[model samples]
Target: MTREVRLTPVNEQNLEPLLSVAVAEAEPDEVMPPVDAPAGWSQARRDAFREFHRSHFGGLAGPTGNLMYAIEQDGDVVGMIRLGRTDEPGTLETGMWLGKSTRGQGIGLIALRLVLAEAIAAGARRVVADTRPENLPAVNLLRRSGAVLAQDGTTVRAEIRLGVSEDVDLLDAG
Candidate 1:
């Protein structure tokens, strides 16, 4: 049986596994995904990614700009989930990436649920996501999680309404 999947707030200390997953899955398998490699695999490229993540992860872009979480199983990192604010107020978008080995097994669905919960707590009334039309895993996850799909061009965008409220209990509230 598979173990229960859990989420840890992403931080500098436990982010290595997340970066590793991106590199390990950069190459497409028998099935191609719309997303590409995390960027280049060179050392310079890796350095750039590290620097960029540090900024975004550090919240330098503001609280709502990039909120990320680490997907964990048995205390080990397996993937990452991120919720980001769009240009529109009170709206957010989500994205996720899992290790090739960790795909399926209901991990993605759970991660998305957790992230969307956090989004709701953060005052997002709506969240949207998009993937290639053939990315059935994502399409299905969104549907199963109650996101409405809007297909256009070669991609489909999933939108979930979290409901607007003036008294949302923000997750970061101290």
Candidate 2:
């Protein structure tokens, strides 16, 4: 049986578990990649990383356009997916990471399908995601989800058109 993984807005109580997942998902060499750094980031880059974690996972309780959702399985948080920068209205970028304990369980594919469905239902015409060139698992996952390779450079951009309803079923078929 498949459990429905819903995207719920994050708040104080859930911050710790979210941070724990983030830390657990990252290896020493993969904490934050250079691509994650914004332009002109100096020491502030590290500070910004800390601030991002604090703001997003510190449980301060504030208004944020960024919608963070926890992936729940068997009533436990196993991973997270974020749908961000939706100001464009019809297009959204997604980022996701799953806990090590939950890896290789085919949960990421299910979570991706759920997020794509939610994005389309929320009026997103296209959804995009980027991953490092060396992240083979993510690359394969995106391709398996029917995301076309748009740009393949230092970072790879994968996009799926949500304007057509068939794309949703294609992603969910597996």
Candidate 3:
């Protein structure tokens, strides 16, 4: 049976699960290519990553344009999604990660749909995401979601314009 998962806005009380997912997905030892590390990162990058996580979580409690949300399945937190630069009028960037046990079960696609719907509901005309070229799953999801690849460099940038007749059948494909 397909499980019903819901995405809800992140808040102070829900920060732990968000951080847990970030820590769980951290690739500390993974060698990122120069393009992936456009900012010229090093071992010190870990601290920067930590700070990013901290600020993201902290943003949930503060007034910020970044919108964070948690994915819940069967009343359990399975993943998290974020929409940055949401205060702008036209478009926003999206990010997401599922818990280890929850991956590959088609939840990611559903979660993405939910977030996309949320973005549209929030008056966003478009949604964007950047993922490493090696991240086939994410790339495929974005492709399958009808997000056009605007930039195919080290980190691919994909985007979708909302309220279009062109649609993505993520749940059916899964």
Using lDDT, rank the candidates from best to worst.
Answer: 1, 3, 2
Query: What local lDDT score does residue 20 receive in model 2, on the 0 to 100 scale?
Result: 61
Residue 26 alpha-carbon offset, candidate 3, angstroms:
5.2
In model 1, pairs of residues that clash are none
The list of candidate 1 runs beyond 4 A from truth reads 27-40, 60-64, 163-174
Candidate 1: tens digits of C-alpha lDDT, residues 1-174: 867778777788876776776667644232122333453475655555565556567441465477677788777788777777677666788888788887888889888888877787677788899888898888999999999999999989999988668456343243
Task: Please give the TM-score that candidate 1 achieves against the real structure.
Answer: 0.80
41-105: candidate 3 lDDT, tens digit per residue? 34355455445544555442245556667888877777677876644346778888777777788
TM-score of 3: 0.70
Better of 1 and 3 by lDDT: 1
Q: Number of the top candidate by lDDT?
A: 1
For every model shown, the clashing-pair count is 0, 0, 0
Q: List the RMSD of every prediction in angstroms.
A: 4.5, 7.5, 8.1
Candidate 2: tens digits of C-alpha lDDT, residues 1-174: 866555554555665566566555654224333545545434545455445544554221235445567787776777777765544445778888888887778888888888888777665678889988887888888999999986566899998787655434322322
Q: Which regions of candidate 2 are displaced past 4 Å? A: 1-4, 28-64, 86-89, 164-174
